[model samples]
Target: MISDPDGTVLALFAAFCRIGGCIMVLPGFSSARISLQIRILLAVAVSMAMLPVLWDQIYPQVTGKGHSYLLLVTFETVIGVVFGLITRYYVLGLQFAGTVLTMMIGFNAPPTADVLEDTAENQLTNMISFAGLLILFLMDFHHVVFSALVDSYTSMPIGAKFDPQNVLITLTNTLSQTFFIMLRLASPYILYGLLFNIAVGFVNKLAPAIPIYFISTPYLIAGGMFLVYFGIAAMLKLFADGFGPILRGL
Candidate 1:
C-alpha cells in the first residue's frame, strides 16, 4: 500500500549500513561467541526499529541516488564503525589494564580462550575483562551506545565526506583517553607490584642464596587477589560511569 516502497527499502538499507556496522563491532553484541546469523539479525532488527526515528536524516539522502548508493553505503558504514570503535576501544582498555595487572602482581595462570575474542589470554586478564564487560552490560551500556548513535545523525550526518585526517585524529584521541583512564584504573596494582617487587628485591639481595623471589611469588599473588577482591567493584563502577561522558565528549 506504500506508494514509494522502493524509496523506503533504500532508506532501510542505508540505515542498516550504519546500525549494522555499529553492531558489527559493538562489545557485547559483537562477541566472537555470538553466531554470525544472530549478529546479523540483531543488526537488522535494530536498524528496523531505528529507521523511523532516523528517517528524516537518512531517507531523503538515499531515495533518488541510485548511482551513489554504493558510496553512501560505504560512508555510512565507516561512520558507524568509527562510532562503535569509540566504545570498543574504551572496553579494550580493561583488557590492557588486566594484562598489566597480571604481570605486575605475579599472577601466573596459563593462557586460555578469551571470553570476548578468540585469542588466548591470561586467566587473570580474561577474568578482569569479563567482569568489566559484564558490569557494563548491567549498567546498560548498549542503550547508551544506541542513544549516541541516534545523536550521531546530528553530529555526523549521513553522506558527510570522510576526512581521513580528522578520522585519524579522533581515533588517536580516543586511544589516548582510553590509555589514561586505564592507567588510572590499574594504577593501584601498578604501585602495589612496584613496591612489593622493590621490597622483595631488597630481601633477595639480603639473602642471595635462598631464592627469595620464588618464595615471594605466593605472597605476591595472594596480595593481588586480596586487592582485586576489594577493588574490582569500584574499578568496574568507574569504568561504567566514564563510558558515557568520554564517548559523548568525543
Candidate 2:
C-alpha cells in the first residue's frame, strides 16, 4: 500500500489541478462569501475521492514524469478552468438578463449589494439573479458539472496536449447559446417596456404641459412588476430546464 507514496501524492495533486481549478471559478462555490480555506479543502476532498476512480488513468501518466509534471499541472488546470468557465458564463448570462429586465421595467432603484456576491446591483436585478441561481442549486446543477468533469478524464486524458483553439470554440459556443436563452427569458419584459414607453411618449406629447415623465414612471414600474409576478415561475422553469441540455451539449 505504501510502495508508491510519492506517485500517489503526485497523482492526487494532478487530479486536484483539474477539480480544484473548476471549483476555483465555479458559480456558487466560487462566490466571495465562501472562504478560501473552505474552497481549498473542498477541492482537495473531491480530488482525493476522484483519484481512486481515475487512478488507472491518472497515476500512469504522472508517475516517473519528472520535469514534465509541471507542464502537466498547467494544462490540467487550464482544462479545468475551461470547464468551470462554461458553467460560470451561463450563470453570468442570467445576471446580464436581470440587468436588462430591470432597465426595461423602469425599476432603477439605487443599487445594493448582490445577495449572492458583493457587487452592487439594482434590487430587481438582484432578485432575478439570486432567484435564478437558487433554482439551479435546487435542481442540483453542481452534480451535472461533476458528472461532466468525470467524463472529461476519458475524453481529455491527463497529459494530453492542451488545445487552446478547441477550448476557445467551446467557450464561444456556450456564450452564444446562453445569450439566446437569456434573451428569450427577458423577451416578455423587453416587449412590455417597449410598448409601455411608446404609449407613455404619446401621452406626454398629448399633455405637454403636465409632468408626464414623473406621472408615468410609477405605472411603468407597476406594470413591469405585475408581469414579473405572473411570469417569474415560467421564466425560471425554462432557465433551469435549459441548463442540462446546454451543459450536456458541451
Candidate 3:
C-alpha cells in the first residue's frame, strides 16, 4: 500500500512548493497590504488540502530526473503566477481608469498614505484600487481562484514543458485588454473635461481683460466634482461589468 513515505512526502512537498508560490502572487491573496505570514499560511493550507486530490493527476504527467525538480517546480510556479497576474492586470485597469477620471475632473490631490506597499500614489487612484478590491471580495471572486488553479492544472499540465511564447502572448493580450478597459471606463470624464476646457479657452480668448485663468480653475474643479458625484455610481457598475468578463477570460 505505497509504503515509501519518503518519496510520497517529497512529491507532496514539490507540489506544495508550486501551489504556494502561485498563491503568493495570486490576485486576491497577493495583496501588497497583507502580511507575508498570512499569505504563506494560507498557501500552505490550500496546497495541503488540494495535494491528495491532485497528486495522482499531476504527478504522473511531470517526468523528470533528480535535483532538476527545480525545473518542474519553476514551471509550476510560472503557470501559477501567470494565472494570478491576468486577474490582477484587469483590476489595475480599474485603478488606472479612476486616476484618469479624477485628473480630468480636477481632483488630482496628492496621495495621503502608502498604497500597495511603499508607493505613494494619487488619492483618486488609491480609492479606485481599494474599491475594486472591495468589490472583488464582495462578489466572491476569491473562491474562483481555486477553480482557476484547478483549470490551470488541466490547461497547462505538470510535465508538458513550459512554453514561453504562449505565456508571453497571454500576458501581452491581457495587458492590451487592461488598457482598453481603462480608457472605456474613463471615457465619459474625458469628454466632459475636454468640453469644459474648450469652453474656458474660448472665454479667455474672447475676453483677455478679465483674469480668466484664476477664476476658471475653481469653476472647472467645481463642475468636475459635481459631474463625478453623479457619475460615480454608474462608473462602479461599469467596473463590475468589465471586471466580470476579465475574470472569466482569465
Assess every candidate by TM-score.
0.95, 0.97, 0.91
Report the error of model 3 at residue 5, Å: 3.0
Locate the minimum summed-lDDT window of 10 residues in model 1.
241-250
**Where does model 1 exceed 4 Å of error?**
none
Q: Write the per-residue lDDT of candidate 1 for residues 1-250, one digit (tens) a residue.
A: 8788998999998989888998899888889999999999998999999998998998888877878889999988988888788888998999999999899889878899988889999998898899888888888888878888899888888877778788788888889888998999999999999999999999988989999987899999999999988998898888877776667643
User: How does model 1 score by TM-score?
Assistant: 0.95
What is the Å distance of residue 156 in model 1 from its true position? 1.9
Model 2 residue-pair collision total: 0
- In model 3, which residue pairs have backbone atoms overlapping below 3 Å? none
Q: Please list the C-alpha lDDT of all candidates, in the order they appear.
A: 0.88, 0.91, 0.76
Error of 2 at 111 (Å): 0.8
Model 3 score (lDDT):
0.76
Candidate 2 residue lDDT tens string, 141-237: 8888888898999999999888899999999999999999999999999999999999989998998999998989999999999999999999989
Measured by lDDT, the strongest candidate is 2
Which residue runs does candidate 3 get wrong by more than 4 Å?
Answer: 61-64
How many steric overlaps does candidate 3 have? 0
For candidate 2, list the clashing residue pairs, or say none. Answer: none
Superposition TM-score, candidate 3 onto the true structure: 0.91
lDDT of 3 by residue, 171-246 (tens): 8988887898778879988998899889888999999898887788888788877887887778777777776666
Candidate 1 or 2, higher lDDT? 2
Pairs that collide in candidate 1 are: none
